[model samples]
Target: MKDFITPDTGTQIGTLALQNPIMPASGTFSEDLADVFDLDVLGAHVLKTIMHGMRAGNPTPRVCDMPSGMMNAIGIPSKGIDDFRDRMLPYWAGYGAPLVVSISAHSMDEFVRLCEAVSLPGVAAIEANISCPNIEADGRAFAMRPDTTHTVIERLRGCTDLPLWAKLSPNTGEPAEVGRAAQDAGADALVVANTMLGMSIDVASRTPRLGNVMGGMSGPAIKPVALRMTYQCARACHIPVIGCGGISTLEDVLEFLIAGARAVQIGTATFQSPTIMARLVTQLRDWMAAQGVSSLGEIIGTLEIPQAADGVWA
Candidate 1:
């Protein structure tokens, strides 16, 4: 029998240390997953985005299937902070894994308040879902521009001493700039992106498939775009970058790691197989041992590019 080599999968995102680099993206993760696998096996448990007040969310027909991915305008329905603090927090505290609370708000003040509320003990970090519409910016996402991204992060920073992970949006033209803004404003890490804006029409009905007409698209189709953004942000910012998008397979996770992401989030894929995240953690360790790699740091940010005769990257 071959000797079993236990590879180290541990990784660090600012002050928080994860047992592994695999975790579920916000909205895709929930307490229900505990029935399928041990929640403590994951690097961290990133809860679904919670709001300041109870929300009904968007109208019906909020989700639509695409050829390669899915679209949703679920509008971040939440039971509000009170329920989260009173019930959800205590339940999650029982788990051994670190808890990362994801929060969203419509205004700058609301964002700060939400951050402060979730900054209680037992919470490992706060992932600010800044991709949502900001009323202060006329319904534009706070992450759509560097200025607003900085402003919101700066204010949130002042309200909490907990590590803040700013989740960026893919809709912006200046992804690197937005990432840098978040880092400069005190974000400990950056979640490379949120879902891309897309719409699908039902040809037979001649109407939008989603009730909201447009929704955030996620899944394998957006992997390339998300990977690119992850690479760019990883290079532009000094803070660690957490890649999120269509990461369903081990290869997808490897690509993001080489692209400079210190950690990666699994989203839509979890719907297909609830045990995927847990399985990937095992697979990663096995693959590392086979490749003679001992730690995650060896694979993180090790992409190599060849230069042409003209001194340009080929």
Candidate 2:
């Protein structure tokens, strides 16, 4: 048996590099997982998205069931950046999965302030929570519009020296255009996708299932949408892409990578099995060995899409 999961499968996203590219999206796997799985084994860890202030978030009945997945109107509830630094940061440092702090801000100042605060020495990097940009005012996810994404990143980009991974949203006009805007606005890397905006209805009750009328749909349901965005954005932007949405098994991870994702995020799968990440990581290592591949990079974005040259994979 050889050391299949070596540093070569390891790759860099800005200044942060990991043994592999399997990371948990913010909010999917909270810090509470230490009770179940050893956080130290993960390739990278992305903290839950926190904001400038503690948020109560939507109403009751925040989650609901959909066809192949679930929907959540989890409006970014957290203990605020200060509280996170005081209570969570210490614990985050202990786990040490290349700490990537995620923060959401409504106004530009709020995002910059949050970024500066989290730029503390212990944090390896930061992932801008630009996913649901509509939290403040708009009718869509905030990052859904290119201008909003660009402005948010531009304001927060210089707040700290740490690398910024702007998580892109599938709720945009053209996924590729927003990907380009993120790169142009100085994103160190792009996390291709948050959940798709959707609502589930209970026909008998004649109302939405979630507390809020709309919820962010995740899990197997959104996998194909995420794949399309990842493939498209990878070609359009020069920055690296960390794919998310419905990644459940070793095969799913491979699909995203072969389609040109530098790394992939496991979302809804974690909810089903908290320890699934550990198994997936182990499986990926075994798969790599069987394929005679010594490194993960060799397989990243290797798909032979003709449109890759144009920054839009078919």
Candidate 3:
């Protein structure tokens, strides 16, 4: 007897299409785990967020466990674009999936420079990390205003010819507005969020947890928040939305799809199980088959949200 787990469903991020919608979050899925599982089996691969300059990152005690998911203040430690191109790109090319290299910088000039540098030979696409703190210049906040998100993509648009995806932050007051900013700024896609900001403390020591005072929270705990934001943002803009934060199971992946996510990225979950991506990919296909769904695209965003008694879809 034959099995029914074949991925008949397919999707694309910009011009680079994918066999499935599941992918790992940047930085969380490292190149060091090649032995544990086959990265080629994945639909796509996004390299960790790299910067124009090398990053030492914040202090130790970087990660901690929370009730639903894990929290981290990793501080975006990258080897820099030049070094990443020299080393990481080679490994990225080895993987069969589309290679998306995430880049971050403080100034518009540095962002443009980094985009130009990394759009080298092997990069399939470039994802700009605008939420990072400006360690050298001023302070750092999630690219709160739409203007900053717009300006960064606009500046980099002229520099590199590669497809651009602006990674948005859920810590914002309005995710949809920022999504539109990315669209207007000429971004090919938008990552609905990086991580929501949350902090924890140890009552015993009377100090905050994690190396940094605050950090981005990701895991099963944030799934509902990510789902709602992704849905709203997708409806607000024409660009595709790559759902991140708290995506753990096939059910979670389905919820994101129904909520309007074109694709989903798996994070914190990977730290506990490197093979989760492959497993989830398999499960998605199997679930699709059981539902008599020929193509995943056929069911995406197809949820017919019933109108309220007052006749409002809300």
Candidate 4:
């Protein structure tokens, strides 16, 4: 009979160590999930975006159904930082997993202020959602270009010593360029992307499906794009790239790791199966053991491209 060995699912994002690399994406995960399964069983806990002030979010029908996915323009509604620190922090403090707070802002100063406020006790790291428009930059997302990416990250970097994760926007044409800028400006890691911009329409009524007219698309449809961005940033930057978008299964997690993601965030898929993240954690371990893999790091960025006879990569 063959002896069994436990496979190591542990991974790190900069200096932060996690038991595994599977975490629920921001906005999708909440304390409610703790009732479905043990929250401490997961790799890390990522909260929804917290802003300087509370927002009501977009109008009705903020989320619209799409083929193999969904779209949302929730506008990052928040209950303000004070409420989160006073009410939510204590609830999460009891858990063993690291708590990562996601923050969004419209200007560099606001970004810095939010970082400082969220950098309180019990917080493990900060994820800056640069996908939001920068009021200082005429409504362009801070991650849309390299210069702005650097400036926003640099300012936020100074505001807090906690691990800073720059979440990039898929709307940008140059993901790699912006990723490099974030790393150079002292970002500890990168969340490869947010959802891609998309919209749906009602043919009969001649009305848009969402109240905001446009929303960010997520689910299996965006996997290819997220995978490509993860590869680009992982290749271009020194920081770890945490892949986000369309992840729902163990195979998806493996695909992200092979594309150079140190970790992955499961978003829209959670809406369908609340227990998905917890199941993946166990399945990932079993699969790795069966494949004779001993460590998660062994598979990170292990993709091999074919080469031509002339010594060029094909």
Candidate 5:
């Protein structure tokens, strides 16, 4: 019998290295998914955002389906740090993939506290969900502005030695500036983007589709926005950028990598196909081999467009 070799999909974000580039976006991932397939299949386990105290989340109708995607205002309901540490930590620690815990807070003090607490031994990295409202800033998200993004990342960086991944929001108009601020503040990587803030209306019912009136839109519909941000941040910052949007197939994964994302996160698409991530892992390896690619790094940030006569991209 002969041994077969698989192409390498491993990538590094800061000092942390992942076996593959596929992971579930926060809020869409959980231990329950382990039942569908092995957790080791993922590059890393990115847990949902955890708060200092429990959150009840938004009102009813937190989720609504759109024509091409979906909107969610689930509000990041959490059982708080204590429950997560005592209950979920042990189970996650059993997995081979690294655990990247996502944390959210309304104040700088709370963010610092959560960052310090989650930096325990065995954790691989910390992903700060800066899209949450900053109570001190009158409810504006920290990632909405360059200054706020710097303040949040700088403070959190000081609290932990673990690799810091500043998860930015797609709702912002200046994602490049935000990415630069995060890098200057010591972020090892950027997860370029949370979700786009959007709303849907029902004509016959004459009311908003979501109970929150507005929610974060995600799926194939938002891939273009996410891809654009990934390209901008990847070029504007030195740190790695992890693209998250509507990735469902090998092509989507390759597109993000080509656009400069060192890694990609699969979200809503997973809800429709539980084993999609596992399938993607195999598909990526096969595609690379078929294309005579030895490593994913070879194809990353390699997009090409012809220049026009006026010196602009055609």
Candidate 6:
């Protein structure tokens, strides 16, 4: 029999060490998946975004299927922080993987409050879903600009000592700037990024498909855009960047790692194949062993680009 070496797939996001770099994106993962596979195989478990109060979320028909992906205006319907602490936290504690609580709020004060509340013992890290609307910014998302991103992250940092991962928005023109701001404000890592803003029309009804008229686009279609942002942010910030977008296969995961992302998050792909994340973990190990790569450090941030005619890489 041909001998194959066992590849080491461990990775770290700030001070929190992970067994592997494969983890589900916030809002796409839950405890129900435990039936499909062992959750401990994952690097981390990022729960859906929770708020201070319960939310009904967006109106019906909030999700629409696109050719290459899907759009959602879920409005972050949460059961509030109370239920998460009393119910959700314990259920997740049963799993060995590190728990990463995702939190969102409309104001800086609320964000700080939520951060403090979720900074419990079982939780390994906190992922700030700053892509949500900010009432203080005239309904604009806090991650839409650098200053707001800095303020929110800084406040969250002050409230907790747990690892802070700032999830950025892809809708902005300056992703690198926003990422740097989060880093400057003390974000331990960056989930680069959130879904892109998009809309679809129902040709038959002559009206918008989503009840909210528009929603965040995610899936294979946004992979290129997300990959670009990940590469940019990973280069711009000193902290690690966890790529999140349309990763469904080993090749996709490898591309993100080569682009400088320390890790990658699987979202819409999980809806299509619940067992995809686990399979990717196995696949990554097999691929690494076959390629004679013993560790992930050989793949992460290994992208090489030839110089342009003007002597600039870009």
TM-score of each: 0.97, 0.92, 0.93, 0.97, 0.96, 0.97
lDDT of 6 by residue, 1-314 (tens): 54678899999888988999999999999888989998889999989999999999998799999988999988999999889999999999998999999999999999999999999999999999999999999999999999999999999999999999999999988999999999999999999989999999988989998988989999999999999999999889889999999899899999999999999999999999999999999999989999989999999999987665464545
Clashing pairs in 2: 133-142, 134-141, 134-142, 235-311, 236-311, 260-301
TM-score of 5: 0.96
Model 4 TM-score, all chains together: 0.97
For TM-score, candidate 1 versus 3, the one ahead is 1
Which residue runs does candidate 1 get wrong by more than 4 Å?
Answer: 1-4, 309-314
Find the number of clashing residue pairs for candidate 6.
0
Q: Write the per-residue lDDT of candidate 3 for residues 135-182, one digit (tens) a residue.
A: 443655436668777878898888888899988888778888888988
Better-scoring candidate (lDDT), 3 or 5: 5
How would you encode candidate 4's per-residue C-alpha lDDT over 1-314 as one tens digit per residue?
44576899999999999999999899999988888898888889999998999888888788988999999989888899889999999999999999999999998888889899999999999999999989988999999999999999999999999999999999999999999999999999999789899989999999999999989999999999999999999999888999999999889999999999999999998899999999999999999888878998889999887675464436
Q: TM-score of predicted model 2?
A: 0.92
User: Model 1 residue 225 lDDT?
Assistant: 92
lDDT of 1 at 50: 97
lDDT of each: 0.94, 0.84, 0.83, 0.92, 0.92, 0.94
- In model 5, which residue pairs have backbone atoms overlapping below 3 Å? none
Cα displacement (angstroms), candidate 1, residue 50, comes to: 0.6
What lDDT tens digits, residue by residue, belong to model 5 across residues 223-270?
Answer: 999999999999999899999998998999999999999999999998
RMSD, one per candidate, in order: 1.9, 2.9, 2.6, 1.9, 2.3, 1.7
Misplaced by over 4 Å in model 4 are 1-3, 309-314
Q: Looking at model 1, how many pairs of residues clash?
A: 0
Better of 1 and 3 by lDDT: 1
- C-alpha lDDT of residue 181 in model 4: 95
lDDT of 5: 0.92
Q: What C-alpha lDDT does candidate 3 achieve relative to the native structure?
A: 0.83
lDDT of 1 by residue, 1-314 (tens): 55667899999999998999999999999888989999899999999999999998998799989878899999988999999999999999999889999999999999888899999999999999999999988999999999999999999999999999999999999999999999999999999889999998989999998888899999999999999999999989889999999999999999999999999999999998999999999999889999878899999989897664464546
